[model samples]
Target: MSNLIDMCNCCNGCSSRRQGYTLKLSFPKKLLVATSVLVILAMVVMPSEARALQHKIRHERRQHDAVALTKDARIRQEELRRRPHRRPALLPQTKDPAERLRNLEAERFKNATRTIQKKLKNTRRYFNEERKVLNETREYRDGMPAWLPTINFVAIHFHTYKKQGATLSERKFAYVIPKLHKSLKEFLEIFDRLYKVEVDFADDPFSNYNRTRHELIWNTTRRLYSTIAEIEENMAAVNVPEQNFTPSKSLQALEMKVDAPQCLKNDYIAFRAYGNLLNNWFSEFKCPHGKKVTTKNAKCAAYEAKLIEKKNKRNKNTER
Candidate 1:
């Protein structure tokens, strides 16, 4: 018990000695410690704050891009809705090879008919201009002297020429197209002859009247040749044979003499008559109708059923 009391006394004496001694840091050392703590705090906090700010910026940019894309899509949809909608032509559903061939032929015939009609309109316009020019000119209206022998070629040929029948058949067209071409060619030749004669007989070859007449005939000739070429092309497209025939000797022999006013009048009459004929012919010519393959037909019904079945299968897939 005495040894234990002695040990306790010794521990208290050592603790008192240690408490009496004070450890003090200088100003520089104190400042160094505070700076180190601040540096450690900045390293940890700054990185986390920077990462949060970057993530927010990235998210905002992505949102803006998405909104722009949505706006563009909506604008495109509105534009499409505002535009006129054209229904796409449905392809004919046919099983027969013969029917397909006929369909193709019918399409070609229709295209050719449309093109010919357009060309015929141009031809009629040219003829009308030519008629107007002839009517307005005093030289064209002057009568021939009563003593001279005159021939009315317009009366002889205009009515007698083979005209288009009420109904135009492909077989008849084969004959008629070539005849029309030949007749137009003859008319062109006659106009060219008349043009030369007018120039030769004019007091001043470069006079306004001469120039106007020249322009009128030139236009008429060009349009006639254009119409003839269009007819030939369409005829070939429709598989019509262009029968090769020599020019009519009788028509060729009927020449316009220089200074013959009666010849001009007759020619004008012929031009008007032929113009009427062309308008009538084009109006009458139509594409031949093909046999329709409707849903009522057995083959077409089967084809349409297959299409419907495929469409339903597609719709089912989309729904799934």
Candidate 2:
């Protein structure tokens, strides 16, 4: 046993030196290693009750946060309610029936004329400005990066236009068609809404003025119905070709893997392309069945011009 304890000679007499060199740590290093070991041990051996208590505390904090957020939202909503929005003046405030009637007539002409002119302007712009941009965009479409945000934006524009077209079709079918029917009840309601005129004892339906206006509305309603019917028939008959331009799939996948700055740059490219495409599509479409189906006609135009002249005269008289 004594020989075994002193067997350094058999092991080349270096065993003692090796033991001394084995993982010698300084005081601070020893403290750091001990702390790390204790931390790991604590994490591994923590009690379930302690963990449940911690979870309960965190859940209570989240509930408190949610309650605070809801309260803040209610306060903000109440503040908003205190401030009412102002509406635009739709008609002149008058006591005399004759003056009110005259003003209503003037307003009818003005509103109708304005509506017609706006429609015409929008139509013209689509053809000139919108068409130009779309044709130009085709030049860049093939050259654009496949993985670019522009591709997605173009896709979005295509889908948006389709959705808008569908919505317009629904609106026409659901609301415009029913409202445009010229029954006596609907006629009165529509006229009241549009002209801000109330029908009272003084206004006889059989009187020349009332009779003429009623006939005009009826004629206009019939024309609108015919136009809408024609549009539906034409749409059913004509099949639009599929859009030629679209983004490549490979680029769209690459976009998912990229960082923020690259993503933003791609997004801008897509948005610009989409905007141009929308304008182009809208421009090419001719108002179905031409000007006859449109609001602008000889009688309405003349009446509109006459109303404008009368308005100018009244303003001048007030100035004098």
Candidate 3:
């Protein structure tokens, strides 16, 4: 065993000597190498730990900010909910019966006129197209009959003409309402008949003229019904008795002649002319002249003006 140990030691010495050096570390040198390795490991590990800490801190800060914003929004909404709501101020009630009646009539008349104007505009549009299509037909293109009753608004114009101290009277409403209704009824019947019958155009088999004719009659009929209702309501408000009247014989005769294209054209022209007359009558009757009557909420207007002033001040400050 002693000899085997001696041989191994001799072989180790020979290998070390062949390498020309034997690495040897003292206690201090060993400590220094260990310190360097520990510093390198710390340099790599500390940065990752710091980065993780920073990320955690940023996430927490974002969560804190979000919570703060939510709290602020809740507070604002609560404040708004606690605030009292305000109602708009209204015009004082007028004591004069005549003045009140006048105002009511004026307001109703204005609204009716606006509605009539809108309907008339739609009627005019449809009428243009209807006229165009009708003109294309051989019968209409040939010539309208001279004996056919053409629409003339001269009588309606004379009736609705503005006179001194003129007001909406029961007499005026009574006379106009029945005539308007009769005209509308006649026009509607004509349109209903035409809508069923195909126009004399082989190229327009789908009845394009009938379609436009339908639109014109529909708008005019609506206008007629609306005007009648408005007049009735106004009469009721003013304590005026509603009078019953039949359509005139002339209007009946016109209705009977709807079978002819010339009569249809005349009826359309009359419908449009009557619509214009009604529009003008409503516009001119009991309407305030040169001055507008309006009711404004003083408090609301003042509040709005104050807000605008504050906004302007804020903008100026920001610019500065």
Candidate 4:
């Protein structure tokens, strides 16, 4: 277009510079240069072209974002729509609620086992962590023998190694715990009955129990066991072993009773394996030598003084 401008069309200061005339044209050299630059810029800057480029950029951006968002949304929606899997055919579903729960739990366990097997030796850390939580939080005990802090805590601390043939399988937990719970139930019934009896005969009828908070806590392990059993039976869908503190011929295979104190001990009870605390409690205090004061024939006053001195010294050393 510039090349087409002829020498005749080129304007002198007053050479036909009027609007529509070929003669008398007049423009300053500076103004003419500016006008020429404006013409070149106008040719380069078509408004419709710039507008189309911006619109195209915006459209492409929207498409890219929509693809990413659609992918993420699809993944989430798929997750929500996923169904829980059923168990294998070998493990039949029982009509009982407890058995049904057990079946579902077995499936869950199988899935976990499969996943863990896939992880191979890589899941040792996770396994160890879970073991710690289970042992710590799931510990149970009865009063006196099992409830003595030192013995029971040590017993719990005794970890069952692979060589010991103890595993964290459900069968192991279910198998061993019910026996432990019998003594627990007996203790609980005794304590609850004791508390009820004592509360009625308090020093003041309206007064709170004379027991210390720690004492109450110490005694409450039995109650906790009872409550846990009830909760398992009702809420956790766990089948609680039949409550048996008295001997029944049918469940005799499960009952292990009274190595000592046949009169005081519950009959149909199978207590916890001789855990450290329980063993120590029975050994130290339940012996024939560990006699209570006899109303008819008492120990010597000198023996009492010596025992009191020993007890005080032990207490002092323990505090330190």
Candidate 5:
């Protein structure tokens, strides 16, 4: 009976140990299963979290881009505000090239008229200064040989030849130059005669010799006056091309004919003043017909070509 009881006790002890071991193993298995489940949840939740982070970063980038675009637009607006306002052109834009050209021509003509007026003012000022210089040097005695410079200076300066394709101003200048040349020639002759009487017989008493000299001077002055009057009349409508008009025969005839009274050789300031006075008249004469014009077709093709070249150069510079 005692042996049997001891054996049963041993068996119970073994069974208890086995139960303890199984409980420990079962705890480990449950722990492993819980760990595995947590790993699976982490795998699924981390992807969603990463996607949310990526969405937030993309939204931030878009916002930054929007801000940058707004800042750039504001800067452009400020820059434009700081810039000067451009003035509108006098002429309105036209689709027709001919009409546009006509408008441009009209504007140019208006501007040219103002330029001509300014030139006239400058001419008068210069001539007035010359008159003062001549007056200061007017201390010559009677019978002095007057030193009258020829009017070739006027001829050289004013003469213009026929150019095949010339501007309106150029053509007008050419048309007027011939008449000016003729007038200058006549003026030189008149000046020579006047200088003879005014300088040579300044101190002479009333006598036949002086009277003859005075008469000759008076007649010459009258002729010069007539010539100036004619020029002034012609200038009223100055576009008339004098193709058929002939210069006076007397001018050509008297090219070498000089039978003036003997006089002492001296600088004559009065003659210079007289010549300049006549020049002032010529300077003031405005040509009513020197109107500016725009070409209807490719007449001013040269001007257009130059404009295109200028634009091309500008574009190349911008590229660089």
Candidate 6:
């Protein structure tokens, strides 16, 4: 048993020595070897001692820039062009109507002034004649002659022009429905609070009226009026009457065709206000009542209704 134990101890000592030789003794050298290997690898990568590299013969080449990736660094073709000019993509959009209105007014005034100046130059005689003719027509129409009621006749005539039915004359209520609803919602809130006497403010519509100015009314006619006005003013400065105006019918009308979405907003407000205005106007007149005897043209509708009434009576008589 002692001999076996001695042999085991010897084997254990030999194993420990082998482990030390393989692991601990070689550890420092191994570390040194690894470091040297890393240094050699690093040297190979940079190759500072190696010869300078010749120009690489690439198959194809194209110039590129990291800056070209930015939005403005790009050229806008017809496909990419959205508006009048190139602008930063990240800008917050602005849609202030007041700002737009001011710009519109300036443009409109310049345009109208240019037009009047042009008319003053070109067709002075004709403009004078037309103004006189309009005045005479107004005078003639104002008098209720023994012959006819002019205003009613003219209104009827104008109304008769709608062969397309009432569709064209009917300003679409649906278009301004959103605004109407908004106003109605507001009105309901006001009504509920009116009895409580909580708020000091009272609603006043007339305070918002713009003075009857041609420029203010016409300003929203088109884009960047000052740009056009600048051109017009320059032409006028050079005594170029012909250059003062364009030949387009649209240009003559001084139309302020608002954007559909924008028009919806404006017309919605217009509809509400105009509805009130019309009511007030009509109420003040204290007229447009009493048709005891039917008038000339619409008497046909009444006659037809009367005939239907008589026919119903005759049928009842016969049945009885």
Best by TM-score: 1
TM-score against truth, every candidate:
0.46, 0.18, 0.35, 0.28, 0.26, 0.15
The digit string of per-residue lDDT tens for model 3 on 62-160 reads: 999999889989998877776533222232479999877766665554444444445545544554454444334433333333322233333442355
- Stretches > 4 Å off in candidate 4: 1-174, 199-227, 230-243, 247-320
Model 2: lDDT equals 0.41
- Least well predicted 10-residue stretch by lDDT in candidate 4: 263-272
Residue-level lDDT tens digits of model 6 in 228-265: 34434544443334212213232222224433333223
Better of 3 and 5 by lDDT: 3
Q: lDDT of candidate 1?
A: 0.58
Which pairs of residues have clashing backbones in candidate 6?
none
Candidate 1: regions farther than 4 A off: 1-91, 136-176, 198-208, 286-320
**For model 1, how does the per-residue alpha-carbon lDDT over 212-241 read when each residue is reduced to its tens digit?**
766877888788878888988888888777
Q: What's model 5's TM-score?
A: 0.26
Error of 5 at 242 (Å): 8.9
Our model 2 lands, by Cα RMSD against the true structure, at 28.8
Shift in Å, residue 245, candidate 5? 8.5
RMSD (Cα, Å) for all candidates, in order, is 18.9, 28.8, 17.1, 18.9, 23.7, 24.5
Tens-place lDDT per residue, model 4, 1-320, is 24334434655532333444443344567989999999988878877689899999999999999999899888987766663443334557578997776677655444443332233222222323322321121123333333211213222222243433322434433433444345445444443432332222334412322333224423354334544454234323434345445532333322232222221232112122222223322222212122453122243333344445766776799899
Q: Report lDDT per candidate.
A: 0.58, 0.41, 0.50, 0.40, 0.47, 0.33
Worst 10 residues of 1 by lDDT: 148-157
Rank ordering of all candidates by TM-score, starting from the highest: 1, 3, 4, 5, 2, 6
- Please give the lDDT score at residue 125 for candidate 3: 53
Ranked by lDDT, top first: 1, 3, 5, 2, 4, 6
- True-vs-predicted CA distance for residue 14, candidate 1, Å: 69
